[model samples]
Target: MFQKIQRFFDQMIVMRDARGGTEISLELATAALLCEVVRADHSIAESEIVAMEAMLKRRFSLDEQALDELMELAREESEAAVDHYQFVRLINEHCSFEQKFELVRAMWTLAYADGEIDPLEEARIRTLSTLLFLSHSDFIRAKFAAKPE
Candidate 1:
């Protein structure tokens, strides 16, 4: 059975519109998930940071200040959290499948941005894909979309 959700991905996606109400935030949850992937290999890379910032700006239309704030909040949340349930719930609620596809692609991008895929990073993506309810084909597609040549 699916768990009932009470929140959204912030005002950006607004999972509350017509469907429900806003209970939390937008960038915070998504960014936390990205932060998790960054920490997967236990070493943050310059390339991964660059890729994440670039994608966040493009996707959320966040300026420098907002981007920095979001990243900081995400880092804090990721550090304090023991699981991915909250972030995954928000994404599944607020984002469309296509959006989730892009998000998964972004995860893959961040994972390989350092020009290598650590097993831990790969494992996180795999587990996250399932939690996000993404199909196997979509998962493979997203991986290929962000894979380094």
Candidate 2:
């Protein structure tokens, strides 16, 4: 599964390079997964877009131009993706437990950005939590941590 993902990301890199776009990185993978959350409900909300931009900028410390490029690349990759395993695999390889926990929090936060969580959005996050090897309790914790007051 991961080998297939590696090949896909490799092709993505080559395609992005040929277009003179920013190279793929862990940041891009993370961003793309967040994009997946945004697209999960089949209705893109401006608030979710804003939340994703803010979260990505703060997390990656990317400047405006770089952030824009990354978002575009992420969106394209998210759309073209065959599955979420690629993004999750890279993150699992690189991130610590705390980092993965925070990522789940971020996904929850994005899911609630529009003031409600669609079932589809929650389902996506649940799938991600399992893929990330998070405990069921930790998944609930992350959801509560990111829930708007």
**How many times do residue backbones clash in model 2?**
0
- Report lDDT per candidate: 0.80, 0.85
The collision pairs in model 2 are none
TM-scores of all predicted structures:
0.83, 0.84
Which stretches of candidate 1 lie above 4 Å from their native place? 1-23
Q: Judged by lDDT, which candidate is best?
A: 2
Backbone clashes, each candidate? 3, 0
lDDT of 2 at 97: 94
lDDT of 2 by residue, 89-123 (tens): 87888889999999999999999999999999999
Candidate 2 least-lDDT 10 residues: 11-20
lDDT of 1 by residue, 107-143 (tens): 9999989989999999999889888899899989999
Off by over 4 Å in 2: 1-23
